[model samples]
Structures are given as C-alpha cells and as structure tokens.
Target chain A: MLKIFSTQLAGIFQNIEKSSEEAVEDAARLLAQSLVSDGTVYFHGTDEMMAVAYEGVTGPNAIPSSHFYDEKTALTAMDTVIVSARFAACEKSAAIAGAAREAGTRTIFIGAAEKGTDLDSLPYDVVLDTKAVRGLIPQDDGTRTALPSAICGLYVYQALHITVSEYLEEI
Target chain B: MLKIFSTQLAGIFQNIEKSSEEAVEDAARLLAQSLVSDGTVYFHGTDEMMAVAYEGVTGPNAIPSSHFYDEKTALTAMDTVIVSARFAACEKSAAIAGAAREAGTRTIFIGAAEKGTDLDSLPYDVVLDTKAVRGLIPQDDGTRTALPSAICGLYVYQALHITVSEYLEEI
Candidate 1:
C-alpha cells in the first residue's frame, strides 16, 4: 500500500514539475519583487494547508520577509500574498485572495484545481496546481484515502522557494 | 533545478517507504490506542514541522480525537503524543516528548535522525525517520537549500493515517 502511495505521490510531484514551471517562475518573480522592495510576502492556508504557510514563515530556508497572513494585515500594491488549500474550492482562501488582489497585492493560489470547482474561475496573478484532486489509495469501502495536500503544497512551496532564491541570486 | 528537486524528493519518499514501515505501523498502533481508549492524541512539531500536527488535527481524514499538542494539556497513560521536527537535534521536541513520557503518555518521535545527533539517543515509543537530514538541492556556493522537512513530515503523517485507518478497520 505504501509502495503504491509512494508511486502515485511521485507521479503528482512529476506532474507539477512537468507543468508548473512557468507558474512557479512567475510566482518567484512576483514574490522576489516584494523581497527586494521591502514589501512583505504574506502566506495563508486553509485547514491542513497551513503547513505550507508555516513553511514559508519558519522553514530552515524560509523566504526573507515572509509572514503568516492575518486578517488584520494591511496590504499595499507592492506586497504579495499566497493562499493555499487542499482544493481550490475553499471559499475562505478564494475570498482572501480576492480581497488581497483587490488591494493591489499580487496573489498566488496553490493547490489542486478540481473539475467543476469554483476555484477555476477565481483570478489570481499565478496558480500552481498540485494536480492531486483526490486521494491516491483505494480502500475496501471503495472510497479513496490518503489525500496528501500538505505534502503536495509543501513540495510546491519548496520549488517556489528555490526559484525565488535563484532569482534573488541573479539580481 | 525543479527537476532535480523532484527527483530528490521522490528518492526521499522512497527511502521512507522502504525503511520506515515498521516504525510507521508501530506509531499507528500507538496512536490508535488513544482513539479506542477515548483518550486524546496530541501532536507537536517544531518549526515548520507544525505542518504535520496541523495535518493531523485539521485534515479531512483527521484521526478521531486528534488535537494539536498544548503545553498545558494534561495526559494519561492512555493518551499519546507525537512530536516532530526537522532534525533529531531539536531539543524542544525532545523536551516535549520527554515530559509526555514522564506523564505516562505514549510518545512517538518523527524526524530525520542525523548521524551523531542527540535525537538518536532520545527514547520514545517510536521514531519514524523521514530520511531528510539535508537539503536536496545544492547551491552555487556549494551549500544545500530546499530542506523540505514539512513535506517529508506530511508524507509520514499520511502513511501513518492510512495505516491507522487500516488498523481500525481490522478491529
């Protein structure tokens, strides 16, 4: 079971790699601008997706000037905000991104954009898909389990972190 | 760079799958005991490792009776606490597990046990190594970055979640 899970997880990671380069690079550039301009990059994640935000704020290689997004945080056009969730259907994340974008803060949305979900219609500066719309393992009850959104989100975060670091080095 | 990061991430996941099965099952059984006994299973993590605790507490398939560990939360023999960190050298995680054990709570430790680190010596009910002691990507300065402790931690959490679900189904 774990072997299968690992294989499928590898597939998800590969999918992100194969398709998310442009988005990742674009996010890095937008986020890097904030870092260079002394504007903060705030992160928010709904539910377990908070892992990704926490990674941005406290990971060993955390991006500089990153903080967890707060409801009271006042944003400016030069700032950037990232909102992550297991699925793009999360209204809270969508609302937060919507509000942030309206404030002229660059917004990046990260997670699985499932079919028929309202997440697809939401506009953001960049959207990096994890491509994990459902759990990888099949159970005896015919339901899927082991939906690892946090892992996928963290993978995206790390990729973006590395790209941002590279972008900073080039500047 | 993202390609290299994906490949290295896959290797780390494979390493955990290959080597951490027994520990994962042991951790699952220990955690399951708390669920069956009407005892709370508390989770604590240092730094970005909090992603694991958040996953356990707020995840869609969160284990019954799981909560984020609070310093003030009292424990009993029936209760279990899982502490995670990026490396075994995190004294804060060790201290939390030690105190929990002293209170007669079953304790599980999760993270990478780097060679010659104190984490290897700290005793717990189970130690699930993430096999991610260093960052996967090397930099121009010959240093490594992209240390994805949270991603590794979440993978372990998902595996344990699946195993515990299986264990409960068997019962």
Candidate 2:
C-alpha cells in the first residue's frame, strides 16, 4: 500500500515539477529578495496545511503567522507572505492573503485549486496549485482514502526552499 | 532540484516500508486496541515535528498532546501516546515518553534513529524508525542538504493512518 502511495506521490511531484517549476522559482526568488532586504517572510495556514507554516517558520528568515489580525501592524510593503490551504477557497487563507495584500505585501497562495470557486479570484500576487488528487486509492470496502494536502504542500515548500537557497547564493 | 528531492524521498519511503512494515503494522494494531478500549491516543512533537502531532490528532480517535506536563491528570493506563522527533534521542521527546510511561500508558516513539543515541533506552513500548537519510543531496556550494525529517515523519503517520483505518474496519 505504501509503495503504491509512494509511486503516486512520485508522479504527483513530477507533474508539479513539470508544470509549476517556473512559479516555484519565481516565488523563491521573491522570498529570497525579501530576506536579503531584511523584510519579513511570513507563513500561514490552518489545520493540516499549518505543517507548511511550521516548516517555513523554522527555516531561516521566516516567521509563523500566529496572529493574522496583527498583520496590519507587523507586515510591511516590502515583506512577503505565503499561505497554504488544503482547499484554495479556505476562508482563513483568503482572509490572510487579503490582509497581506491590504498591507501592500506580496501574497502567495499554495493549495488545491478548485473550479468555480473564489480561489482564482483571491487577492494573491502568485498562486501555486498543489493539484492535490483526491480519492486516488479505492479500498475494497467501498471507501476511498484521499491524499493529505500537507504532503503536497510540503513538497512545494521543499522545492521553494531549495530554489530560495540557490537564489540567495547567487545574490 | 525538486525532482531530485522527490526521487530521493521515493527511495527513502521504499526503504522504510521494507524495513519497518511489521513495526508499523504492530503499532497500528496497538493504537487500534487503545482506541477500541475507549482510551485516548495522544500525539506530541516540538518544532517542525509538531506537524506530526497536528496530523495525528486531527485524525479519528486521536488527541493533540498540547500539555505534556499534565499528563498524569489527562492520561490513564489505558491511553496511548505517540511522540515524534527529528532525532529519536531528543531530550523533550524522551521526557514526554518517560512521563507517559510513569502514567502507565502505552508509549510510542517515531523518528530517525541516530547512531550512538539512546533511542533503545527510551521508555517506549514501540519505536518506529523513520530511517531518514542524512546529507542525501549535495549542493553546488559543496554543502549537503539533509532530507527534512517532517516529510518522513508525516509519511510514517500516513502509513499508520492507513493501517489504523484498516484495523478499525476489521473490528
């Protein structure tokens, strides 16, 4: 079962790499610029996607967005904020992205892009679609298990980290 | 870079599935028993690894171990606690495992098993080694990037979730 899941995940990663490589690189470059300029880089997510925020904040030059209400006071125009949600239309995620945009900071949303939703209309400067595949594995018992969004979100974050590190080196 | 990381992760996942399959199955059975007996299952971790706790608790029949200091009041002998760390020998992780042991509950420790560490000495009923590879990728700047433990830890949790779900089906 794990081998099957791993194979599926490997394919998912390949798809993301092929389609979202430029977006990941561009986001990383922007984040690297913010870090180099002494501007804050904030990470925000709710529920399982919070794993991405935790991973981001623990790394260099990133802060955890614990208090989104205080973003107006804390975030500056030069800063960057990255928000992840299992579903791109998550209310809190949208609110955080809106707040970041209001604060004149760059906002990036990373999550599954849903059709006919406000996800595409959100005030994000950049959006990296996780392309999370749901119900990939069907059990014999007539139930299906969905892939956890945190895994895909973390995969993207890891790629962004590597790209950011590389950009930092060049700058 | 993301493709490279994903390929490495796929191999790591395969290695863990091959080596720790029985351990994962056993741990899942134990967890299932605890849940069936109306015992609480708690998850705890610090830093980025806290994501594991978050993931675990959000699932069925699990609680987040937010306050480890009050384990005596909150946990009983019938309960089970799972703790995750980047290194199995983390001091806080060991302390929590000890406290859970003192509380007379079943304890599990999941993480990378470092050489020369007292991971075997921890008071855990079960130890699921993530087998996270260190220095998996070498960068152009002559520095090696270690595989993120959170990714491996989450992978283990996902497997455990699937196993536990299957076990729940049988009972």
* Candidate with maximal TM-score: 1
Off by over 4 Å in 2: A59-73, B59-73
**lDDT: worst 10-residue window of model 2 chain A:** A60-69
Of the true interface contacts, each candidate retains a share of: 0.84, 0.45
lDDT of 2 at B61: 18
Q: Rate the local accuracy (lDDT) of all candidates.
A: 0.87, 0.75
lDDT of 2 by residue, B1-171 (tens): 666677788888888888888888888887887888888788887677776776776522133232232345577887888888877878898888788888788888888888787656888888888877474577778876846688888888888877887788888
- Candidate 1 local lDDT, A1-171, one digit each (tens): 888888888888888888888999999999999999999999998988898888999988788999899999999998999999888877898899899988999999989988787654885788888787888998778999888688888888888988898899899
Which 10-residue window of candidate 2 chain B scores lowest in summed lDDT? B59-68
The complex in candidate 1 yields a DockQ of 0.82
Candidate 1 C-alpha lDDT tens digits along B20-111 = 89999999999888889898999898889999889989987687898899889988989999899998778898889889989899988878
For candidate 2, the docking band is medium
Per prediction, the TM-score for chain B is: 0.96, 0.88
Off by over 4 Å in 1: A118-120, B118-120
